[model samples]
Target chain A: MKNEDKDLTRRKTIGWILRAGIGAVIAAIVVKTSRRSSGGRLVWQIDPRKCIQCGKCETACVLQQSAVKCVHGIQMCGYCKLCFGYFKPDAPRLDEAAENQICPTGALIRKFIEPPYFEYTVDEDLCTGCGLCVKGCTNFGNGSLYLQVRHDICVNCNACRIAEVCPSDAFVQVPENDPYLLKELLPRET
Target chain B: MRSNILENCMLNIGYWILAAVAMAAPLTLTAASRFPQPEFDSGYVAHKMPHPAPDFAVTPMMDILILVVALCIAVVLVRKVRSRNWILFFGLICLGWFGFIRNGCFCPIGTIQNVALSLFTGVRLPLVMGLFFAVPLIFSLLSGRVFCSVICPLGALQELFIVKPLRMPKSLDATLRIIPLIVLSVGIVCAVNGAGFIICRTDPFVGIFRQSAALPMLLTGMGVLLVGTVVARPYCRYFCPYGVLLEICSLISWKQVELTSNECINCRLCVGMCPVDAIEAPRPALSDKVRGRQFKQFLYLLVFLPIIILAGAGVGHLAGAGVAQLHPGVMLVEKWQSVEEHDEDLFPSIEAFKRSGGTIEQAKMQAAEIVGRFREGCMYSGVFIGLILGLRLLVLSKLQGRKVHQASRSRCVACGRCFSVCPNK
Candidate 1:
């Protein structure tokens, strides 16, 4: 009985030692890694420069309608009489006709500003994020239109399905405070 | 009037000169500069892009607080209160909060990959994720498997669905139990080699919680739940990588849930109550002769351990080459080869690579490196699995004699069903 009691005590001591050792290791890892860890919430965004306009973002998202939407850089716009982003390349005339629009969903709304310059805006409710308009703008005119993850609609899946299928690997994680990867300035050669 | 006309002519000439300079500039300049910004005569301001706010507002600190509070309640309920109904109610709350409300991301089970990746590859482990991984383990060491009992949303989800619990054969149960250790080893190996979080990718419950998963994953979740109705916490018992860690911790835990507060009446009422088959019946003491034979068998098995591990490594080395095909880089190379052979159109990935100015030679080299890493990871994982299996066999060969019906320290989830069923209570 005495020997059994001694065995029990020894086992208990070993358990305690193991627990303490594990706790210390955990503490050390936390202290060591915290400094290098990316602070704050990390949310997914797209780098406009690397995006290939693959049109996968429309169908690949976990949401019923994708969180990706076409964002126009108003400052970058050429404000041309015939905006490629707003109208198809082979449009019969520079008019706001549904068949002539580059956007399949007619999400791009063109408003007359002056005799020569036109103002373009995206209707978020109607935008399907197919990147067709983006492709048109990028190929023919100033590449101002780009797809971005709208945080309001995005559930922020751990593994973004769109990122998985992205051919150019444009998807990147940005800090929650600055989620949008906006095209503020034109890409210039260094 | 003559001076004003001269000013207008000079301004037009200056604008034409600027346009000429821009047109002559190299193509390196962005397309945006092709057309000059219209000088808005009406003083109209261009609309700046709007950054919408995120929907979920819960902070990491709040999540940690709730996790800690839930663990404490589980421990108290299991050890002190000993109410199965209360534990069930608590589990339901955890399922709602962690599963549905949080969308099931960054759970302890999935954190195993992050922790493994961080430890092996020197990747910076997020502070919140590190805490999420460690706290449950610490709690399990202090108190046996209370985390598994009520705190884990996955386990809770399974528990909620358990109906008509059927007993599995002891041999089958023990065999299936080895799968979790294998999964843990493979999961860690994949994470360390930067392959990807296989555990999170394959998590059946997370899909159900998020309500937005691929068709196969949804089908898998439904299948697991359907199986869980009879098997009782099938994922927890046979598949959860985190559960393997919790089981180890709980085995050496300082305290455990008592089946009965009073002396065992030997009525055997609680034996059948445990849905997970965690209860052990009394065993007759082994004679010295039988013990000597078992000791000899253990000694023989110990000698074969190294040979077993080497065999496993050899098999893994072969399997690794095949498994490496799962990597996207390797798949890309394979696809490129097939396209070359068949004279097919370039795939999207290949097109992107070509557009980015990456040569096929560069892609082939990257794929070769990933294959090498996969082989190394698989070999290491094989060794780990072999070691675990050997140790398990050794332990099983020399079993201890039990005096009364009791819960298995490592297996019992502390759901308190046994306590409710114990006649002595």
Candidate 2:
């Protein structure tokens, strides 16, 4: 009977020690995550330059129309009348005909700017991040159009599909402040 | 030079400390880092060199809290708490919180791939992630698989749906048990070779958590959940790659998690209680001659381990070429440069490359980089699988005469079901 009592006591002590170890690990996890989690709520976004015009942002996202939207740099645009982004590459004319658009969704809206230049702006709701217009512009004209994660629509899935399938790996977790990487003037190379 | 060394050490320490805190939250702990290039666009025409330190991603600190609570709950269930219903109720709560609320992102099961990736690819591992991956395995070694029995949400969810547990024959169970080993080997090989986390991509329960997945995956999850109503944690027994580590640890465990809190009465009441068919009936004593022959057979198999490992390596090398397609780089190369793998209307990866104007040369370079990693990793994974097979066979051949029905230490999940059936209670 004495031996049984002693065995029971030893088992209890061992259990207590195990419990203490678990407590310590839990405390460590709490301390670490809490300390790291204070700065700001950062969410996934695409860096325009790193984007390789992968249309995956449109299709891969769990959301029906992807949270990724095309953002045009207003300042970078030469505002050409024959906007490569607006008209298909082999279009008969530079005119804004619905049939001549390269964008499957026709999200790019053309506007009258100067005599030979026309400004193109993205329709945020219609922009599906298909990257067709961005591809066209980057390939032919000044690379003004780029994709960005629209925070309002993005669920910010822990694993961003665009990031996963991205050939260039352009997607990043950017702070909510300074969300968009806008266009800026550059020193042209001679 | 001394000062430089000290400074570098300090920086490294500080970086790790901060990284530990970052890993505390269950953000996607993917093996590879996202946003490879810091540049926004190649032709921004701005001062792009001085890229600001991107804001630290601050997700909810709920995952850490849940994990800690899970540990507490497992202890409570095992040591203090007596009621099985209460344990099931707690499992339901965990299923809701960890599964649906958190959406199962930083699952320890999936972290096996990340751990493997960090080992091979020099990916920086966060301290919290290392702890998360190690804790369950350690628990299994020191005590038993408390993690599988109670902690993991994936298992917890399955526990809730276990309405009528069925048993399978011992041979079939042994055959199915090898699957987790295969998955672990394949998962590690693909992850190390830059194929990304195939385990996470193909995770059966993730669909249940997200409330949204591809139709086929969602249906598969639903089907599994439905089957779980009768089969009792089929995935846990057969498919979970993470279970392989826990199973190994449990096999060599010092502390045993038996069926009862006290001595089992040998009443055979607890015989069919184990949901995953982990309990074994008392075996009649084997004659000395039969036991001697079995021992001899075991010795013969032991001598063949090296040959088995070499054969496994050979098979693994052959599979590496096929597995390389999991990497987008390899797929891109095959679609454009090699042009031998497919005859489709263009897979999404190829279509993405086309829009980006990616060249075949670039694809070839990417393919070579990925395939090169596989040349080393895949062969090792195969040898590991062979080692596992050899050891399992050796263990199977060993005969220990038994007088009492026993819980297979490696297979038992320690869910405390048989505890309720003890007549001593």
Candidate 3:
């Protein structure tokens, strides 16, 4: 091949390399940035200061079932037999009968804590968004159980459907720019 | 000589003006949404524009007719480049301009449907839904690829950037063709699943020409355009789903962008010149006796067509089933299908379940059926696209390869080789 032809080929080859390289770089940036930011250490949590954990989260979500699972604040519980969070005020029986217990998934296990005292801990897997337990606890006893948005499932539509219908309007459009919403219980005063 | 140049210049100038007018008028009038919003430091979110179809009475028929007219004009131009026909090309160009610019949309094939669906369905915000799928198919049936040749913003932009052209190897071009099909298949799968429109999301060229300032998409668009300067319409040739539609349409087209000004001499001047590598040398015409023998074998083509279609569809159906089997969403939907007597009257009442504190695992199981059906839809679309491309290749192989031609089909990048090569020009 002639010298001129060789030079042209060299130029074209360089051009192709530059183009391909640039395309790859741009694609890499987009795929990296648009992710839900699970990499951050702070997970989505319920703010104890803000949460009333009303059963409304259970009803208004667009998902076939709401994914707002109830979380427990173990430190706040007094372990009373008449645990306000566990039983409805109109309960006919105090024993662990299905109708008497407010927890639907039977996630909250109630254990006897001496005379007139009971303690409660939550089993994460079976908890559904019925919020009956949350309503029982917050209304009659110290508000410990609360509803929180699980980032894993929330589609995070630009306008959250739940936020619109929320009676408490508890749902907030947290910035994807800074993703975590906390539900931590501060250390109780000794 | 001056008069001839003047006429050609006049034609070119007229088309340019029509293109501008076609683009601007629609944008001003209808104000359709700008897609893949350009990003900048100011953080300007793309302002959502109302659907323009209502204002102009846009319909699939209008898109189809305009494409047909455009095809007619293109055919006439190659067959006989007259001043009057040039006028027709201008008119068609104007329609394309009106369709896009005035309407403030890209490729009206699907835009009209999007508007209608938004006004009527009250569901998902479709990026490019409804009529888009139908518009291209109808035009492909009536005339050759009208959308790809002109009017497509990407195509129009490509026309400007292709200042120089170089030949790509046949092996390379064939390899590149595979990429577009893969992209089209992926896009279809994503769309069917209601995930997102991959075509709009991943469009690199649209970003570059339109100055999509969105850093990520804009950067991608720039990357593609820069490649075009060297490779020539890389997006259209290798990736555009619209291109796939056009290729299928070209097969049945009464009008073709012809290679030769007169009879094929096998000189191959046109082959090297085509930037998109469209032109090829004609095969040796059979003598009457040879032709008679070929005619005897023509019945086989009819038999093959149905066989190909059935095989394609069957394969597509099975693949779709396979995807449905794997997706969690499909499985979830299946569980809910039998239970019709629900509060909301929908199989998977997501809201009701959310209230109950449901897990993703549960939703996945319940929504599985919906997911499966969508996969099945996507698989069929993929198989059909594959069959069309296969048929195109089969027909293309029968023609004479442009081996000895000065410009082979693979070598030509539609760089206007024959325009200057023409003795008439």
Candidate 4:
């Protein structure tokens, strides 16, 4: 009986020690794994330069509506009313209306300047991917508006659905390594 | 019985710890080095699918090959096939191709997990974590613990730790099953809640299997593995969310590894030998018709196919675009580009550009382009989600014996005829 008790005690002690060791190991791995800094592996990547910002992403996407929304690049704007990006080649009238306004969201807020000159700004919260504004800007004004994949919500599938349907073919598949493919512009352009 | 139970409990714990330690060592080294890229990972811009870390992937492939060879040998042990030549052919492939090189570069499970975690949590856990979760679950479900039988590094490590095999109390073993479920549930909840990936933080098996990341909770995972070595794959048996999924999948899995009843001669050796308790004691044979119908019933879960697709589309729509908010890595990109910092200037110029249509040479055109592409991507995401869910359901449904007779199973008997002639059999 005494021998049996000693054996049992030995097993119990060993078990406890083993359990402690396991705990330490798992802690170590989690600590190690979490610390690794590999970059994101996003499937839907955009080239800011290639994007004409036609806003096809808003309409052509397979979602019920569209997940594409408008975003801004603040550094490069002159903000003029004959705003090459927003206005038609020849305007019947300059007043804001469904026909005159390039943006579907009425997201563009115009500030008055001298006659025939106005500054416009985008209400990002309201801007959808309907590229009415982008098309207007690129064709008539500076090509400021461009499309991008909002990494926050992108599913990043192996094969991107938008890439297949894109009329412009602007999308490209980024490698699992160094996922982001942000657009680069010349110093003068920015 | 008491002594056996005691020994089983001790051994089980030992095995768990051993496996956990083995898995953890490499991962810890990685963590200390700021999680350096695996040697095989191609850092080229074109390679978007994350590669599995070398330590985790390479070791397991070898182990799996070894197991396949052993099983083939066992197959020869039980059944005498008239086409002995075919057996040699199969043995070579099983030992060479499948055993050595897993054909697929990225395991499906890993991709699914990465996408899922990115959606739910705001962080992109290392792509390896996703694969780590996937490999075992895929193998166990499709091939019946073939992963456990052969290629899992943690499993192999635990075998070394286990000094003795002892009978454990069924009640205790049964109770431990809850661990994996709890772990899985917590992981999912944490992921969805945007709290963090519990799997990454507390994955006990990964510590022993792969070196992916470094989180504070790895210590706990290691402890769990050490305990498992003596106890017999406590993670697989009780705590792996992927394991639970594999268990559900095994219900309809077409392929299974087992000993034939005819050749068994009532020997119970295999039963005791199974480390994870996956084997079932042979029961009285049920009528083929009943078995067929039961199989058909299992397949009925596929009807929800369209619903799954629609749900994904609908949810994708509601979730809105801009995956950056949901994934920290994307957020990092936003930071790198300074999107939020210059919001005031960026918004107006882009807005003006959209208003103008490139008459101006300002940054507005760039902004306009970005907005346009993002919208389209969102739409495609919805469609893709819908299609995937629909197809998954369809496949699950189709698996349910849609036809009264199957080409694979319609043979003369559960006979060794096809088994003998087949290369993969």
Leading candidate by TM-score = 1
In model 1, which residue pairs have backbone atoms overlapping below 3 Å? none
C-alpha lDDT of all candidate models, in order: 0.81, 0.69, 0.50, 0.44
Q: For every candidate, what share of the true interface contacts is present?
A: 0.45, 0.03, 0.00, 0.02
Candidate with better DockQ, 1 vs 2: 1
TM-score of chain B of 4: 0.39
Tens-digit lDDT track of model 4 for B288-392: 777676566655545555566567556544443343243332333343356554463344333333344443333434433443433443444555545643543
- Ordering by TM-score: 1, 2, 3, 4
Q: Give the top-scoring candidate (DockQ).
A: 1
Task: Show model 4 residue runs off by greater than 4 Å.
Answer: A1-174, A177-190, B1-112, B115-142, B205-218, B260-262, B282-425
- Estimate, for each residue in B23-66, the C-alpha lDDT of model 3 and write its tens digit: 45542232112111122344322221111111223343464466
Off by over 4 Å in 3: A1-190, B1-104, B108-143, B208-211, B284-358, B389-393, B396-417
Instruction: Give the better candidate number (1 or 4) by TM-score.
Output: 1
List, for all models, the DockQ compared with the true complex: 0.37, 0.07, 0.01, 0.02
**For every model shown, what is its TM-score relative to the native structure?**
0.91, 0.73, 0.45, 0.33
| Top-down DockQ ranking | 1, 2, 4, 3
- Better model by DockQ, 1 or 4? 1
Question: Ten residues in a row with the worst lDDT in model 4 chain B?
Answer: B404-413
lDDT (Cα, tens digit) per residue for candidate 1, span B1-425: 78656754654464356446645666676777667788988777788767697766677667678889989989999988898999999999988888888888768898888777777767675577788888898898888999987988898998988887899998998899888977887777666765556787778988778777778888988899999999999999999989988987888788987889888887888877788988878887789889788889989999989987887788767778777876778888888887864353347788788777787899999999989988888887788777777777777885467788878888899888888888777
Comparing 2 with 4 on lDDT, the higher-scoring candidate is 2
Superposition TM-score, candidate 2 onto the true structure: 0.73
